[model samples]
Target: MRIVSFGFQTWGRKTLQALIDSEHEVVLAVTHPASAQSYKAIWADSVEELAKEHGIPVHLTERADAATIDLVKQAEPDVIVVNSWYTWMPPELYQLPPFGTLNLHDSLLPKFTGFSPVLWALISGAPEFGLTVHRMDEQLDTGDILVQRSLPIGPTATGTELVEAGMALIPGALHEALSVLEAGTANWRPQDKTARTYFHKRSDRDSRIDLSWSAVDLERFVRALSEPYPRAFSYYRGERIEILAAEVSTVRYGGTTGRVVVQEGGGAVVCGPDPIRGDNHGLVITRVRAADGTEHSGAEFFTRGGYLTDVPE
Candidate 1:
């Protein structure tokens, strides 16, 4: 099948490679241009570099402009495969392919349907998360599912770890969807409207930690935002401190929320709630990056009485 793929970042590279490895012909590969912003997220293999190595044509653009649409139309693609893309694709672009568009989403549809689906799924304390290859519609991720599979999220798994696990399944997932299409046995199901949850793209504020959160939730939040996504952060002394890793405190500390309860080799123990069930729990911040751009053990950064609050302390 002739395919035109639109993607970016690591997921893009994986999905494109899956297509190349398969029997299908990928005529055009489209990706986002390099960013000039400081604090870029973690990345894997470059989609552009991989496409060039495979001799696939590359198109770099923010939006699917007239020329891009024209280019895809010229490719005469059988299907459009889109994964890990940021642009809002118009129907004209996805509808160009005869087989319709297949979108590779990080989570199963009707749940975690929007930006950072994996992260949102993890933070929501879901026992499992999955990937889905769905037929794209006019709505965002509201497409009918063609194929889906779920994987367990281990207790200690970080966001990067989960991402890698999902990436490992891409080749098989894409193959499954493609095979279904080839055999004409595609089973499409509409996502349950009641079970749907849409997560918006994160911002600096989204990464900001609220000490009011329970230790378990705080830990989940930190891991969810860890490397490749932005690290969950808080302000201290008018400087931003990114929390790379943290743990639920062994001992409960009662004081002002976000107050530094202790500074030990284990990390900075911050006061939250007494872990009695639903109250805020304590956190042991294991690792952090200071405002001066220096990474440090939480013990090295937080002094006794130095609170890690939203407001500078």
Candidate 2:
């Protein structure tokens, strides 16, 4: 098949590699322009590099400018496969290929249709999450599904883990979807609009932790934002402390919300409620960043703690 690919990040690199391995003719590749200021440079690789290695034409543009469209027209590709491209596709550009454009979405379509689907899934405590390859429409991710596959989100899985898992599934899904398109026997199921859910981009403030929330909820929040991104945090004693790791403990410790009840075994039990069990629960914080920006175990923070007062405004 004569193919053109549009994507950014490691996911784009992996998909381009898959096309090469499958012996498909990838005539061109498109990706977002690199930025030096943002942390995205660490997480994403240049798609242009991959395209050049394959001797394919590459377009690194924030938008599909006239020149990019001309390049696609020159390639005369039968299909355009998009994976994790940051920009929205204009209809004219998407329809340039004869077989139409297919997009790889991180979540099962009609469910998570916007930015940061995997992160939202982790934050919501969803046990299962998946990917979908679908026909690109004017509406975001509201397209006919070409293929779909589900994967388990282990209790400890973070946003990074989920993204890696989803990336692993892309090659197989792309191949299957492409084969169907080539055969003109592509079987697509219409998405259920009534069941669709949407999410907006997460803000910096979204990472803040609320002490009033249940231990279960807080635990999920901490796990959701751990490591790669900023960890969930709260203000204590006029200082910001990042809660890096925590667990819902069985120990019964009574104190006001955000109060430190006990410190033992490199862990500290803090007061919070349990929404699931409908009782007061203790948060076993294992790791944290101190007010002075020093990283330390929960036990260390507990030993130095005075009274954990109310959340600062």
Q: Compose the digit string of candidate 2's lDDT tens values, residues 7-48.
A: 888878888888888767988888887775333553577787
lDDT of each: 0.83, 0.79
- Per-candidate TM-scores read 0.90, 0.90
Regions of model 2 farther than 4 Å from truth: 37-39, 252-254, 263-278, 291-293, 306-313
How large is the C-alpha RMSD of every model relative to the true structure?
Answer: 2.6, 2.7
State model 2's lDDT: 0.79
Return the top candidate by lDDT: 1
lDDT for model 1 comes to 0.83
Kindly list the per-residue Cα lDDT of model 1 for residues 1-313, writing each as its tens digit.
Answer: 9999998888899999999999999999999886644322456457899999999999999889998999999999999999988878988999878789999999978888888788888888999898999989988899999989889999999887897888888999999999889778899998887888899876778888987677888889899887667788888777788888888876655656666655345454454555334244478887889888889877777754466768675
